[model samples]
Target: MLGAHDSTRDAGRAQRWAARLAWPLLGIVISLGLWALAARYISDVEVIRAAFAPQAGLKALVHLLGSGELWPHISTSLQRIAIALLLAMAIGVPLGLCLGLSPLFARISGPTFQFLRMVSPLSWMPLAVMALGVGEAPVVFLLSFATVWPIMLNTAAGVAALDPAWMRLAQSLSATRWETIARVVLPGCISHILTGFRLAVGIGWIVLVPAEMLGVSSGMGYFVLDTRDRLAYDELMAGIVVIGGLGFALDWLARTISSRWTQRGKQG
Candidate 1:
């Protein structure tokens, strides 16, 4: 009986994986077909043959990868995102905690925060460049600014929603303020923080592509521009694919981390 049950479970798992894989493959095929159809209408024979064909894009991807020309751009973009995310967390968490803990502060600053958050990150690029001078500094600033709102708002909401009973219990235990915040508050709010971080990462990454196009050199965004200027549409498409792949991987990592954290929280 046990062996039969194990076999059934294994089969189910295999089926689920197959289904997951199949849908994406189906989508890719449909997309390629559409591209091919569109390519037929293009006036430029070379552009149609090279840029719009899936095989051409794949070849370009392979060539770029084999040549290792995309590595520096990838690394630079990754580093910028890492630094910007860390900066957002450092600034956002404390602000969120404060807003969460204090009703007066929340009321006072909430409108202002919402207003600032509504402004597009791109609008600030010119100002950032003027103030910071053209380099990674402005990119970091724009990304950090763009990403901070989600983290801050999520953190604040989590803190605000924490159980009053938890606070009472900590008070009864005579926990120090710092002790309560470190042990009780932070742990209780971690799931929310992680949720915020996930959102911040996604937002930051999307913004990072454009942010990289700023005065700084060597990033996926810069590569895209370079390819465009050089009229390498196939290579440009390849870069887009690389960006999408990296973004997907980052989101998957975040989801995995969030899931594990939730499971651990439940277990504890």
Candidate 2:
């Protein structure tokens, strides 16, 4: 009976995996078919074909990979993103904890945060350039600024939602302020923090494309513009594909980390 149950579970898992992958594959096939049809029938097929044809774009992507021309752009973009995320986490987590712990502070600063957060990151481009100058600094600043809000808000909510009994228990045990926070608050709110981090990564990556277009010479965004200027439409499309694929990979990694943390919390 146990063996039969195990077999059934394995079969169910396999079925789920099949469905998960099958739908995306089907969608890709349908989309590629439509793309090819458009390339075949469009009035300006010659002009559009280089950009629209998946084969051409794939060929360009392969060429770029083989030639090693894309590595610098990829490295620069990834480096900026990593640094921005780390900066956001460093500022946001501490600020969030403070806001969560102190109602008075939250009341004082909440409106200001809301106002600042409402402003689009792009709107600050001129100011960032003027202040930070034409370089990686402004791009990193924009990415960090855009990502910080989600992490901060989610962390604050998580801290607020932690069980009051945990705090009381810590107090009863004569735990120090730091001890209570380190032991009770941080652990209890880790799931929320991870969720926030996942969300921030997605938002940050989306912002990063435009952020890179700002005065920086080497990044995916610059590559896109460079390809366009050089009339390498296929390479432009290939660069776009590279950006999308990298963003998807980053999001997947963030999701995996969040899932693992959630499962660990459940087990604990």
Candidate 3:
């Protein structure tokens, strides 16, 4: 009876795992079907049909991967994102802490920050290109600008939301300001920082394509434009797929990290 029960339990667990995976697979199938339908229905032109079909895209992607042509572009884009993110964190976190800790500073800079944050990142493209002179500099500048506001704002909000009771306790203990902040404030707000980091990542990525269109010889955005100029629609579609996949993967990573941190914070 014990052996039979254990077998049944294992079978049930396997069924649960299958059921868990089914929806995502079904969704992918439906998406592919729709893509195929759209390709066929959008135009009766054979060239368009052949270029836009999902199979054509998959084939192009596979060829690019197999030929190792896609890796460089992928690496270039990822490197830019990394640089921009590092710059954003360095600037945003400090500014955010000041904003949270100092009412006078927040009040003084509040309007400037608010106005700039409201301005769309793309609106700065012309100015950025002119000022930075169209290379990786301009591209990284735009991405960093797009990414920084969320990080700064969320960090400020997180710090502001920290408990006064905790602050009081620290003060009563005669803790130095630096010690209090290092020991108390930062630990309390990590989840919020992670949330903001995730938001910044999504915004920065969306901006990256347009930002890279300036004068860069490589990167996914450049590859996209090159493919279009060459009339390589299948390759363009493959780039789109790769971009979407990367974005989804990034967002997933951010969420996983944020959730894990939150859970760990709770456990501790």
Candidate 4:
């Protein structure tokens, strides 16, 4: 009976894993099929063909890899993203903690924050270029601007939602304010903070491409423009593929990190 139960459990686990893997595989297959159909039925224009043709795109990607030109673009983009995300976290987390802990602060700043958040980050591109000059700074600023809101708002919400009993318990134990915040408040809101970080990273990654277009000499965005100017549609498609793949990978990584943090938080 014990052996039979163990076998049943193993089978169930295997089935769950298979099911989890199947969905993504199916989606990829469907997407490839659609691309193939589009390549065949779409206009015979070279640009269109290059964009849709998997073979052409793959060839272009191979050429890019061989030329060693792609790495610089990718590196520049990633660097900008990393810097912007770090800046956003530095600014947003502390502000969020303050707003979350103090009702008066939240009330005073919340409306202004909402208004600022409502302003599209892309709308600031022209101003950013004019003020900061056209280069990596503008791109990093834009990405950070776009991403900071999620982290700030989520952190504030998390703090607000923390159990009141924890605060009371800390007070009863004569804990210092800093001690309470560090020991009681931060741990309670950690899951929410992780959630916010994941969201912020996703937003930052998505915005980085367009942000990179602000006259940067090298980045995936510039590569796209360069390919278009050179009429290398295949290369353009390859750049797009690289951008999408990188974005997906970043989001996946953020989610994985968030999951690990959540598990640790729960265990603690």
Q: Put down candidate 3 lDDT per residue, 203-268, tens digits, no spaces.
A: 989998878788899999999999999989899999999999988998999999999999999999
Model 1: residues >4 Å from true position, as ranges?
Answer: 1-12, 42-49
Model 2 over residues 101-190: C-alpha lDDT tens digits?
Answer: 999999999999999999999889999999999999999999999999998998999999999999999999999999988999988898
Clashes of each: 0, 0, 0, 0
- The lDDT of each candidate is 0.90, 0.91, 0.93, 0.87
Q: For residues 165-234, what per-residue lDDT tens digits would candidate 1 score against the true structure?
A: 9999999999998998998888889889999999998999899888888887799989998998888888
lDDT of 4 by residue, 1-268 (tens): 9999999999999999999999999998898778777887777675676566877887888889899989999988888888888888888888899999998998999999999999989999999999999877889889999989988888888899999999999999999999998998888887788788889888887777777777888999889888889878788878988999998888899899889988886787
Question: 235 in model 2: Cα distance from truth in Å?
Answer: 0.8
Q: After superposition, how far is residue 62 of candidate 2 from its true place, in Å?
A: 1.0
Give the TM-score (vs. native) of candidate 3.
0.96
Clashing pairs in 3: none
Q: Which pairs of residues collide in model 4?
A: none
RMSD in order of candidates: 1.9, 2.6, 1.2, 2.5
lDDT of 3: 0.93
Highest-scoring model, lDDT:
3
Collision pairs in model 1: none
Worst 10 residues of 3 by lDDT: 185-194
Model 2 TM-score, all chains together? 0.91
- Cα distance off (Å), candidate 1, residue 267: 1.0
Better of 1 and 4 by lDDT: 1
User: Which residue runs does candidate 3 get wrong by more than 4 Å?
Assistant: none
